[model samples]
Target: MTTKMREEIDEIPAAAARLLDTQTDLIRDCANALKKADPKTVVTIARGSSDHAAYFLKYAVELQLGLPVASLGPSLASIYEAPLKLGHAAAFAVSQSGASPDIVAMARGARAGGATTISLVNTIASPLAETADFAVDIMAGPEIAVAATKSFVNSIVAGLAIIAAWSEDKALVQAVDALPEHLQSALALDWSALLEPLREAESLYMLGRGPALAIAAEAALKCKETCELHAEAYSSAEVLHGPVSIVGRDFPVVAFAARDRAEASVAQTISKLAAGNAACFITSDKATGGEKLPFIATGHPITDALALIVPYYGFIESLSRARGFNPDKPVALKKVTETQ
Candidate 1:
């Protein structure tokens, strides 16, 4: 029997296509609202896999819109009962279920604080969606896996669509238009290159820079959830600052390098880690010592990073089975975390 995680992973490409095709009206409406607001800063609210999606958008917004994006802690509203002055900002809250209390709380707080808030959620009827000024149903369908696969991809894709529309950037719009085909191609990639080193390993490090850092973080979380391995994600620069000391012959590092401005620097860092005899592999051809993993170039920086995760999802799901665990039902984890 195929695991739910594997089935969901395989559905990722179709899930992305569904969002792009069916959610166009919602995407355009939200984008038009953002364009009208013309906010100076963008704030994001999310947790876990959703938070990682926010991180990916942070870089894209900064790079494309020339505006900074910050991730606001949900505790300010949910736990501390504090408020923010977001009159001149925009807030994007991403959630698969859209039912988390803290996510809904922060989103409501952002709206009350005067931010033009929007939600990219799988569940359109959920609380987070109701609280936002505009809600985009990401159209990932019902994901049965405890570990998020399709929803994560759709969240990022939905955000990218909004960004393209808001900025009116022809290049980005083209990139967004081309993602379904690129994502389909990404599904076939075999990242089994990570298997031998990661199979028996108890711990690992995932490295990336810029938007790819978000992919690295998501990959690290998936490793922990599915394979029960301890994994840490760090920027290419930050790891050398201290984390590199802990890396030895037994350590496995997977560097995620996209076809973006930061690719060479990330590849360079991977090469340095490999020189220390760490079992290092990278997703770029620029790295010298590290083994190169295959990556699909989506002809855009942001999509290049996002596309790397599909093969990774497949790899981790298979790794879970190999290690005698069910990826669909990772121990002690629920599909929706209703944190307050």
Candidate 2:
């Protein structure tokens, strides 16, 4: 039987297309507002999968716009009641449900701190949207899977669109427009080679650099939430510093490498780990001894990083089924986590 997770994974390309088609005006409007604010810093507020999307956008904003971005802990506003000094800053908040009290509180705090607040949420009617100065509804549409698939992808896409518009990067704008086609191709990628090792493994490490590090984190989370596998995500550079101590024989390591500046370093790390007898797999073909998993290149760094997750979502869903767990109803998880 096909799972809800698989169905939502298949919907990703269409969902991305629909988001671009429907939210272009909102994205442009938010970009115009951001341009006028000319904030020197960008602050992001989120948690869980939404936070991973924030990590992805942090790199894009810093790289393209040359403005440093930081993620603000929701507890700062929710628990500590601390005030942020963000007068010369902008905030991007992402929540699928938009009902989390902490998330909503932080967005309000950002706005009160004089940041131009923008929210990307699936539920436009929720409090987080109302708290922000601008809200772009990421039309992911009725995600039934407890583990977010399309919404997570669209959240990143929506943020990228706004950044594209703000920076007026013609190439990134074209790349964003062309992502549906790349996403369609991404679904066909077969990562079945990873199944045998991951299914039997007790724990694994997922590594990436730059924006792809966020994808690695999302992939690692799905493995635990869906398959009950123990996984941790780390940057390709940081993995060798401390985490590489666990890289003994047959230890599984999945390294995500996009066609960007960090690719060579990631490949080098994967190769070194593979040489140490770790069951290392990498997305790029440039690595030595590491198994090559197929990936689609979107010709832009940000989109290329986003595309890596499509096949990974597919892989983890099947891995979940193979491990005799329901990917849709992960034990202890609900579709909408109303965290305060």
Candidate 3:
């Protein structure tokens, strides 16, 4: 019985606190750099769950600062993506460890093109941070288990700081800043309602669109690593594209409804699924003006966005115990996945 093998959940709350505590300066500097940045557009380079964070950041940065945001997928970052045209804009390569050579190269390319490159990572001195004009450390610390328990939550926190820094919005910062405390409270909520279906199910799909899709994708990734469950994530539209075919009564689609224009479309999809008798668990804030889906409410939009990730810590961790799998030590998965 290894200590690393058993103590993932117990360590997360403390690790998250450390990540937040150490990030004050990083947040301030990233915010300061973004303050005077007359950026034309924004681009993010990331992979796996980090890719989804880029999607969420794109929406938040665009909504708060009104800048166009795009994802430079790992595949495209090295080869396919064209020369980014935003000469004076901002580009961020978000990685948990700042590994991912391709994103490093992409950030370097953006720097070569005279764009301001920023790296967001958990480690202070990672390769991804080496080339950026600025770097925001997530400070989730050590993350001894490979599935990225605390780093994911902290990266979202760091992203919120970037949002506050760029928009100079104190109200939003306070809301997000207060979340670690609220998250401790959120942890006390009876999560059985959320975890039961997953415990019994052979398969589950966590779905969301627009900004919240990234949260769902990350939730799915966590479920896979911790519980060894067959879980996946896709855009609400992308799910409707093909995943709808496999949808009968047993398959559940956990959908996220955001406050933006994408909300209407996502709500409509949930309605269609309900009409067909598919199991749908929907979570959102009041910003949706009350969708017809069975609701799990959250706080304000930005806080709500951050809170969407709160439920799964217990959900997967509990499920791992029920199924006798060690959620912390996922087979063959390492903390830093290195590749060219």
Candidate 4:
């Protein structure tokens, strides 16, 4: 029987298509609001997988719009009751459940602070949605797995759509429109070569640059969440600073290098690691050293980076089962963490 996580992974393309088809108007409206606000900077609120999604958007917003994006800690509102002065900013609250108390409180706080708050959420009727000036239903359907797959993808997809519309970037709009097909291609990729090195490994490093760094972070979290393995994510350059000391012969390193400006730097980093006898693997054709894992190019840098996660989701689910853990039910975790 296929695990719920695998099933959700398989549904990613369709979920993305559903969001594009159904929520285009809502996304456009949100984009219009952002344009009207003309905020100097952007802030995001999320936790867990959703936080990783926010991280991805932070890079996207910075790269595409030249607007700095910051991730606000939810505790600022729920615990400290500190008032946020965000009148000159736009806030994006990303959540699958949209019911986490801290997340909701932060969204309300952002709106109260005069930010043009937008929510990208799976549950349309959620408190986060109600609190935002505009709520975009991610349209990922009902995800049963505790480990988020489709919803996570859809949240980023929705955010990317809004970015495309807000910036009025024709190329980005076209790229976002073609994501469903690209994601389908991404799902068919095989990264089984990673299993041999990662199966019994106690810990590993996931490396990337720019937006792919966020993908690396998500991959590391999934490794710990599903396979019960210890994984750390770092920028391709940041790892060389100190973490490189820990790498030895056969140390597993997965580098997520999208077809972007950062690809050469990422490839260079992984090549150095591979030369040092680390079991380095990369998702780029440009890497001279290390085994190249299959990846789809979605005709846009951000989309290309986002596509890396699909095959990764498949690989992690399989690794979890191989390691004798259920991907659907990781220990000490629940589907919705409603922290106060």
User: lDDT tens digits, residues 1-340, model 2?
Assistant: 8999999999999999999999998899999999999999999999999999999999999999999999999999999999998999999999999999999999999999999999999999999999999999999999999999999999999999999999999999999999989999999999999999988888999999999999999999998899999999999999988889988776899999999999999999999999989999999988987899999989988899999999999999999998989999999898888776
User: Candidate 4 residues 176-257, lDDT tens each?
Assistant: 9999999999999999999989998999999999989999999999999998899999999999999999998757999999
Using lDDT as the measure, which candidate wins?
A: 4
How many clashing pairs in candidate 3? 0
TM per candidate comes to: 0.99, 0.99, 0.84, 0.99
Output the TM-score of candidate 2. 0.99
Off by over 4 Å in 1: none
RMSD to native for every prediction? Answer: 0.7, 0.7, 3.7, 0.7
Per-residue lDDT of model 3, residues 148-208, tens digit only = 6566667777787778867888777776667677666555544555566667677877777
lDDT of 1 by residue, 172-204 (tens): 999988888998899899999888888899999
- Model 3 residue 58 lDDT score: 80
The worst-scoring run of ten residues by lDDT in candidate 1 lies at 5-14
Task: Give the better candidate number (2 or 3) by TM-score.
Answer: 2
| Candidate 4: residue 253 Cα off by (Å) | 0.4
Query: What's each prediction's clash count?
Result: 0, 0, 0, 0
- The 10-residue segment of model 2 with minimum total lDDT is 331-340
Q: Which pairs in model 3 have colliding backbones?
A: none
Scored by Cα lDDT, where does model 1 land?
0.93
Candidate 2 — which pairs collide? none
